[model samples]
Target: MRFLVDECTGPAVARWLEEKGHDVFSVYDDAPGIADSKIIRRSHEEGRILITNDKDFGGKVYRERSPHCGIVLLRLGNERGQNKISVLRRLLEEYAGRLPDQFVVAAAEQVRFASKEE
Candidate 1:
């Protein structure tokens, strides 16, 4: 899978995804401090899933109808760095196959998926 990892997601998540043989581009390294709209446009142009911790993307994607390849909004309850990485890693390991073309929320205990009809 191809991913455009947002700044708040941190380097750990990007590295883990790369290690799993997925193409990962991180805003922290590639375009530090860029605006979210630009980043979302880049993700759409590149056909990469936008993986972000920012909840704003959900509103932007749905209410604003932003163009995107896909979206994975990590809503992990734990704010610790390790906890975030762990939950994301587990989500990728267990549910990656179900992620494309959908808006997904991955929390510490559960994963929720949403699409246009839902």
Candidate 2:
């Protein structure tokens, strides 16, 4: 899988994704301080699933109707990198094949999929 890890999502999660053999573009490491709109556009253009903790992206995709390859929105209460990784690990383990073109919200205990048309 290919991923664009949002800067707020941190480098640790990006590194862990790399260790899991995914092609990763870490905004924190690669392009710091880029705008959220550009990040989403770039991720869509590059066919990369975006891993982000930013809730503003929800408005971008749902309300503004921005294009995206896929988006994994981590809505964890913990907000720590390890917790993010654990949620993502479970998400990929169970839903990898179903990810593309979807808006997915992963919490500590559950995963929710939102329709693109919604």
Candidate 2: how many backbone clashes?
Answer: 0
| TM-scores of all predicted structures | 0.91, 0.98
Q: How close is candidate 2 to the true structure, as a TM-score?
A: 0.98
Best by lDDT: 2
Candidate 2 positional error at 20, Å: 0.8
Relative to the unseen true structure, what is the C-alpha lDDT of residue 36 in candidate 1, on a scale of 0 to 100? 92
Candidate 2 clashing pairs, residues 3+ apart or interchain: none
RMSD in angstroms, candidate 1? Answer: 1.4
Clashing pairs in 1: none
> CA lDDT of 118 in candidate 2?
81
- Model 2 over residues 88-117: C-alpha lDDT tens digits? 999999999999999999999989998778
- lDDT agreement of model 2 with the native: 0.95
Model 1 quality (TM-score): 0.91
